[model samples]
Target: MRVPGSPRWAYGTFAWLVFFVVSHVVAVFFPGEDPTGDGPWDLRAYVIFNLVLILMSAVGAAVVVATVRPWGRRVPRWVLLTPLWLGSALLVVRGVPGMVENLLMATGIRRGGFVGAQDISTAELWAGLGINTYFFLGAVLLAMTTVSYVRRSRRDAHG
Candidate 1:
């Protein structure tokens, strides 16, 4: 809902990313039931994979925070823009379609035929839908933060 920096968008983005990092970290260490039991990925592999995700998320949070501070001007334009655009695009691409598919299934417009769709209980589908919503939301927040960054950068450049 917030589009401007007046609401302190960068700080908020940083905080949400921190929450994401914390949640993923907990999920990695504690683990959870994977009903599908999809692959041969053992705990070690799972931990490593999740750690990589955690690291990426952490870096994103750091970028938002670092670039908002007074010292941010020293950071190159590419350093700020690259991850902001790339991460937002990636999240939108990953999230939006999955959400549509899930919505279709939920409405019974489509059924029984999508990746990981078969044999999934309604509860699981709803859970997945919720997570996809989070992804889409994260993309939006990141994009907003990017806008904030660009505006600040432009103002600074003009001055």
Candidate 2:
């Protein structure tokens, strides 16, 4: 079956994945404070966490390229779809709670854990908000892109 292409969606998703990759790189090197007043995770833990984030971003980019390119038609459907599906699930799972918590804190509907926490800087709060926003936007974009790709591919295959 010919794979229907969606260059705009693919490019947009690629851009977001690039942003995610860059953010993870900054996170690994700069190393921000833990919002939960959790004293410093081990260096190994930080390394592992950031590595996973970077890897996931790369996988997302790969999926976008595969879905939009003619060469992807030669690949097995399960191979192309599995990572996209998994990435969508993982992004939504990670994004939603953070998005909600930040929204609540920003609107003054509820105090966050950082509230009343000693030694937590304003920078930390703002950084958390920014990160959460990025995650939420990225998750939504990825989900939409994946759905569009799948629907278009199915239609093209059948028609």
Would you estimate the TM-scores of all the predictions? 0.83, 0.80
Model 1 agreement with the true structure over 1-159: per-residue lDDT tens digits? 545654277777788789889988998867878722678777778888878989999999878887688777789877988998887787778667767776777777664325645677878777777777777777777888888888778777889
Across 11-81, the per-residue lDDT of candidate 2 in tens digits comes to 78889999889977987787766622364767778778889989988977988888878887777777877
Give RMSD (Å) of candidate 1 vs. truth.
2.8
Models, CA RMSD each: 2.8, 4.5
Score candidate 1 by lDDT. 0.77
Please give the distance, in angstroms, between residue 77's alpha carbon in candidate 1 and its true position after superposition: 2.3
Steric clash pairs (candidate 2): none
All models: lDDT? 0.77, 0.76
Superposed model 1: Cα runs more than 4 Å off = 1-7, 33-36, 111-113, 116-118
